[model samples]
Target: MSHIQKLLFIIALLSSSVAFGQLTEDPEDRRDQGKDPFKTQTVDGQPLPFSQRLRFGGGINGFRFGNPFSLGVSPVVGYQATERLIVGIGGTYNYTHYKAPYYTPTTYNQFGVRGFAMYEFIPSILPNLYLHGEVENSSIQVKDDQTSRSNSVGVTAPLVGLTYSQPISRRFGVNLTALYNLNYNDPQGVSQYIYGSPLVIRLSFF
Candidate 1:
């Protein structure tokens, strides 16, 4: 099996074990006896349990002076490292083009690796949402000849965001995230830059 499949299989085994123990501890219980141990979190029908997923998305932002346009793509693959904690590695690339009446057109590019972790605060809620945080190390470069000269910014900008995930079906879901700059240290010291959109909508596949 693939790595993700193996992980899901292992999680299934663990969850089944816990379920079996719970059943054994109280064999006389009638309410929880007939239910499937691997029951899913869905209203229409029981969807398949999800321990991992892959998300892809792109968008534009208004961070620039002249409503600069930006496009990016991220393939975030995540695994439930534990029941409450998930870990993932992903890469992102963003290219921003700027144009203004009083300023020269410029393009900024960034590429970096991303890491994510989440904690499930409540398990009773179906399609549980997680309180998430993330960190990324990006190599930022700018190409602007009309502006003054300064040192290039090649430092890491760390950010933290809250992520909410809701599974719509067995293999489809939506993830909304809001991120902010946690370490506001600009090497060039000319701007307070935000790393990502205030609200991001991600469609995921398992």
Candidate 2:
């Protein structure tokens, strides 16, 4: 008789817990369960507001002590394509000076336009790390020290690498990017606006 009473008590407690869970469960939470959080930013089955989807950010690159010194600013506008993806375009301008050992050096102005897409696909490597890819076209005037030939040419350089972002606020952060230029050794060659090597590293505020 006591065993039968204990079983009935256990069944009653289990039924009450289930009823309480159903009474307190959020409809929105239940709807979002098992759904991808990184899907396109949307709410209530519609797109997010315009102000939430469009954003502006930029970065600057400058170094004064080197064989080739470059100082420039890039201003960019981006659209949030998804929760983890951003696409943008930027304008680049840098004042560059190349000092050759045997030739006279002059300050040359370099201008560039760039398009970029960055995706935060891996959170395991580092939090807020992104894979960045860019294509930049920069125009510069060059003179060969060997032949003294001078010409102005535009070079299209493709860069692929990773960026580590440390967020300071909801809107701004510091970004450290390490990139390798795929076209650095191509016939078009590297740009005078870039830092000296095929390995390009940048510390910028965004």
Candidate 3:
């Protein structure tokens, strides 16, 4: 009778062990199941939370001729809304020294605010390429070269462009973009050296 009881106890223990083993999940499977599909993965192989996927970038241009000097800086902050889409806000400040043939050199300062979006369409084939668009409003102090009088003008510009990005590291990179302004001929628009051209090249860092 004691032998029979011992046999039954051993069988019960084996059954419980099998059941527990079947109920417990593998560690790797558990980790995979817990991952959120909407989370953005960083270049460093770390997962970034939705709120933490903010990026910042900008560009600077400076040039000097014999008598004319120009400097411009634009800074932007963006949020990664999806794996391939980014939306941002930007601001620009530019200073230029205009020296006409007969007139004295006049200093001009311009300030602008813009909203922009970028979408990566062919990331699999070209990971660095993106389509860019922006709408900007600029307030410029226009100075009369001959009269020495100044007036403020507000300009609204809508631009579309393409951007190519080169990544140097996980957090740092460079972007080259060519943009065309749609409202370049607006009568009320401020005269922009960069936007006035058919093709404008911008170098930015992220």
Candidate 4:
């Protein structure tokens, strides 16, 4: 071959070899084409891995100088639409009875209902910890049977919280959470709104 033709042939061969080396060195190039990053396949069809969870719990608060105590019940249900996002509904019921001096004994009952969507800042299983928040609408009703007086108030309560959960087994775990409540309404005539302090609790369940 002529000198110029030989030089051209060598350059073409080197260029092809470099491209071949690149194809072998990059592992991701062999992945399936036309694959969607946000979609996955399931037994039924192309569906996301969605999960549903239900939790119910009860707690009591006793007054320091009173015999009458408060009883509470809360039930929460959540659906995980993605690895780091959850949508949920929770409801709470509370009842307390007390007696005032020179007055008939009375009872006060509070009922709350909330629905929320939350996102996890850190999504992992091991030593699980995340920043969680929820916005909820709640209603409070105060009824006095003796006086035949009834009061009903509706407000929005936003909760900003942090939760950490540790797994003990496949069906059992423990979690601790701290939460703050935000109130949306101002007090009106003969109606007062009060906020309690934040709450911290440790929970264990199956």
Candidate 5:
């Protein structure tokens, strides 16, 4: 071939190779393109791994005083669906002791299961503030004063609330919430004390 023709052929081949490389994305980048950006990014803008999105935590509530004492524990497992949302399932167990100066003391045991969801507000004026909702069903057993027999009752409670979260570490956070139970006033409900007081405070960790 003539020298001029050979130089033109080499230039054309090199140009085609460069174009081909530019058109094909790296395999890693192609894989990343399928991922949801909101799910992958942490609050600090770092990429979060799928395994790290699984979270486990719960909370304890109640107060122990002279006349009436109560204690409860709830444990949950949750998935971080997105940077702004999380869903979880949990179980609860509680013990209560009630007494008056002139009346006999009564003790009761309660157990429940719950499902919950939380969504954080965007452009969050109060950082990490979220709206929370939950549905729970509980069974309670108490001994009758006259018959000395145990009576069992069931209650379904659905609650809505607001939560404030504080991140303590990359994988851990603490949340405080004030919840109002919607079914607390149900006519068929047997839980009078809790029904009369519908507002509940919850503290949780995740």
Candidate 6:
């Protein structure tokens, strides 16, 4: 081959190699893609690696501090929709034993399902503080004497409030939320799951 032709061939080969290398990422770049939180890729306005962005947990539905002794749990599964928002679904099951001065002792069962959302107002300054909202439909089984609606009825409660999240360990955490049910004054007020108060204070764990 002529010297000029040989030189041109080498130049073309080197240029092609450089262009190919530019199209591919190095090992270091791949590592950064996974660990860089702020620069993460997003899917539908949420962070990528959807599975890892999920959190599974539950909350304390009720507890005993007075007359009607009760205990319950609200298991939830959530997705980190964004850096500051979380959305999830949960279910509740509560048992209460009420004993008053003149009335005979009785046991009540409450079960329900809820959809909830929480937004962190100041994640950088107060990472644990959150504004919470939810809507729940509860089925209560009560004696005919208690409610105007025959025996068993379903009540819908729409609530909005605040939450404080405390992470105990890598795998465990606690959430304290206070919610006000808008339907608290409905006809089924007597069958309130969290006592008879409109102001509900809840402490839960995951």
Residue pairs in clash, model 6? 60-204
**Residue pairs with backbone overlap in model 4:** none
Worst window of 10 by summed lDDT in candidate 5: 22-31
| Whole-model lDDT per candidate | 0.54, 0.68, 0.71, 0.50, 0.73, 0.71
Indicate whether candidate 2 or candidate 6 has the larger lDDT: 6
Q: Judged by lDDT against the true structure, how good is candidate 1?
A: 0.54
Judged by lDDT relative to the true structure, which candidate is superior, 2 or 4?
2
- Window of ten residues with lowest summed lDDT in model 6: 36-45
Q: Which residue pairs come into collision in candidate 2?
A: none
lDDT of 6 by residue, 53-108 (tens): 56788867667756677887888887777667878899988777666664445566
Residue-pair clashes per candidate, as listed? 0, 0, 0, 0, 0, 1
Output the better candidate (2/3) by TM-score: 3
- Candidate 6 is scored at a TM of 0.69
Looking at model 2, residue 8 earns an lDDT score of 100
In model 3, the runs with Cα more than 4 Å from the true position are 1-39, 42-47, 62-68, 102-104, 145-147, 192-196
lDDT per residue for candidate 2 within 61-125, as digits (tens), equals 65566766677777877777876777788887766676778335655566789998878987656
Off-target runs (Cα >4 Å) in candidate 6 are: 1-47, 143-150, 168-172, 191-194
- lDDT winner between 4 and 6, please give it: 6
Off by over 4 Å in 2: 1-46, 62-66, 100-103, 143-150, 188-194
TM-score of each: 0.58, 0.67, 0.70, 0.53, 0.72, 0.69
The Cα RMSD of model 2 versus the native structure comes to: 13.1
- What lDDT, from 0 to 1, does candidate 6 have? 0.71
Candidate 3, residue 77: lDDT: 85
Record all residue pairs in model 1 with backbone atoms less than 3 Å apart, i.e. clashing: none
- Name the top TM-score candidate: 5
